[model samples]
Target: MSLVLGCNISTFDSTTAPADLFNAVRDQAIAAEEAGFDVVTIGDHLYATPGAPDEPTLEAYTTLAALASCTNSIQLSTMVTSNTFRNPAVLAKMVTSLDVISGSRAVLGIGAGWFEPEHDGYGLEFDAVSERMAKFEEALRIIVPMLRGERPTMDGRWYRVHEAINEPRVRDDLPVMVGGGGERRTFAYAARYADHLNITCLPAQLPDKLRALEERCAEAGRDPRTLEVSFATPMVINEDGEKARQQVEEILVQSGVDASMASEVFFVGTPAEVTEQLRAKVLAHGVHRLMVNLFAAGQDLDVIALTGRTLAPLVSGG
Candidate 1:
């Protein structure tokens, strides 16, 4: 089967990011489009995590807006937006606006807010994991209908929207992508509302995640094939095998870890080796789309281009 592949420019903790942040991401988007990636995405976060507090991070939707004007053809999206970051109605309108600006190339990828530090830092609502998941479920109840140009009225426990209107939606089929591999809420939401599910599991765990997703779809009485599955993980590649292994070792060492543990989530190799691992771990497991995070190398555009070029041709749809 043909595959759908996308590159992520998520700067979650990339401290050595480019001095010109916007231009770097924009150039990455342009290069991704040229290299045949289906889409380019960024993480949605106000405060940095794991990395230093002062590390550069661009707000997700704003960056997408900028990328929309500067590039053409590539779909623009947040790999997964936090549901609590904006009010449900406001979130729906924001994505619709993005679709309008990008000429129908927007995918609203959202998740239950997990980073409590970011919530505390921004003074936004921070609930327990269960509560956040519940609110996220309700948010989808509002967002899905609103994106379809409907006037939805929901008296949700965490949110209430009455006859909310989102107009000027470019297409009736604009896709909503659900991120995270939660067996409970995220899976249910993907079965009910999302067109895609970006599984946040390590490559080795993908097969199990796919089965859980299918189970969720069955419980929802929805067709499982309707929801596309994408594996989300860090992809680090280099032309030299030794250099690639060194990069992996450096990351592991700096983080005070060992190579064996890091290898589960990080893919570091020459293009050919990367392709082999992806094929064996992801594609062989029946997942067809890959949302690879390649920003750990800072704003090195050549790395992005090489990674994209090597894999895109093999994964592109007809």
Candidate 2:
């Protein structure tokens, strides 16, 4: 795969009225599609996490379904649906439904559930990390086969499925993407079941994560090249490069991210500067796939267009 760029719409402007929220999201998706983005993903959460707890949040699949109606060709998915949020069989069927609705442009991006507050607020069980990974593994066992058109029947500790039949699937070869940074369980799961692995880590940690993923792929007797690797980072771009840098600082402070670690986690500057930073810090390290959340742009159409226009060429040569 070449350098595939995606936009992750993880935040919503709190100022937007409830009735106009979906329209705002739809516009952003359209902007992304027109700007040359290959995919537009939404975060799955009952409530916002990286932002204010009371911020307006949309359910990932529901929003994607709506976007499918308004947008033409851009792929739709969750940044990652929490495995804890839905039953594995049901989630599999949902993605299949999305695929049909989107003209075969749905990708299943999922992860072991995180964000404790959301779980607590919703009365869902938030287990320890190891326990969550255990459940995640079982979920994948059921999910992967179903996506491939198999009727998987497994009685696992956390989930049980009895020849779950998914109907109306647009294609059996729908891509499954696993997002996380754990080299042990996450990478192993990705190697075993996922077509794409979205590694969430700082720039400096990417090399080690990729190496671990390679090792896991080898252990699974799969070619590492078959698994597309991607890195997602918070991005802020402006014509005024200094202003963009200032926005980055403000975001880091607001998010309580340590100032010393800003460069490792953020891509902020003019379009050219951000592109160069991505080239040196991400693409050069062998991760060709990139997903960026435009934290500073919000629902701004022009900024999103500018970003897509500038970054889309990164993959053109390939």
Candidate 3:
């Protein structure tokens, strides 16, 4: 993967009327695509995360399907779908359907489920971490083969698929993205199976995480260069540099992070300043691909367009 920039629409404005939520999201996706983003993604959660419990959260696949209808070029995916939420075979079919609908622009971004509260609330079994990783590994065994147009039959400890079939796939080469920070299991899985790895960690932690991933790829007898790695972070940017910094500081304080460490957690400032910050803090560490959630942009079209036009160049080698 060449340097890619993705926009993760992780939150919706709480004040928007319930009936108009999808439209609001659609507009944002259009803006992102028009502004040169390579991919547009949303979180796969039954409830809102990284926000209040009562906030409206759309189902990931459904929202991506809706986005595919309106956006022409940008790829559609979940920031990371939880493997615990659906049967692996079914999840593979959903991705294949999205690929067909979007003219072959769907990416399967998945991870071992982590939110216990959602699982508990939905009465889904929240297994131990070891069990979850085991299930995730088994899921890949089933999902990958099906996505490649082969019927997969597997009777594993956590999942069973009997030659499950998938049809109407636009392409068998749809990318598979695994997102997580676990150095042992997650990194190993990404190296072994994933085409892309979105490492979820603070910016400063990336160098060490990249090294660990390299080690994992070596252990798996796979070349690390074959796997694309990316980092995702919250970004706050504006034409007004001081105002953006102030907003970032407030968020840092609310999250109980030191205000002084804002740059390590967020890309904040004017677009030019943010570009420089990203180069120093992210690209310099060998993480060329980046996904950002522009929480501050909200439904503001101008802000979204401005940020995209500014940051897209970083990935395009401008």
Judged by lDDT relative to the true structure, which candidate is superior, 1 or 2? Answer: 2
Which digits, one per residue and each the tens of the lDDT, describe model 1 over residues 1-318? 122788888664344346666877788889888877888888898876436556778899999998999988889888789998999899999999999999999988899978787888888989888889899988999999999878999887989988998988878777889999788778888999988888898777877888888899999999898778888867788999778777767666655677777578687788998888888888787776788787566357788789878877656641
**Mind giving the per-residue lDDT tens digits that candidate 2 earns over 182-235?**
999999999999999999988888889988998999999999999888898788
Q: What C-alpha lDDT does candidate 1 achieve relative to the native structure?
A: 0.82
For each candidate in the order shown, give its overall lDDT on alpha carbons: 0.82, 0.88, 0.87
**What is the Cα-based lDDT of residue 286 in candidate 2?**
76
Candidate 2: regions farther than 4 A off: 1-3
TM-score of 3: 0.95
Better-scoring candidate (TM-score), 2 or 3:
2
- lDDT leaderboard ranking: 2, 3, 1
Instruction: Show the lowest summed lDDT stretch of 10 residues, model 2.
Output: 1-10
Clashes of each: 0, 0, 0
User: lDDT of model 2 at residue 135?
Assistant: 96
lDDT of 3 by residue, 101-131 (tens): 9988899999999988789888998899999
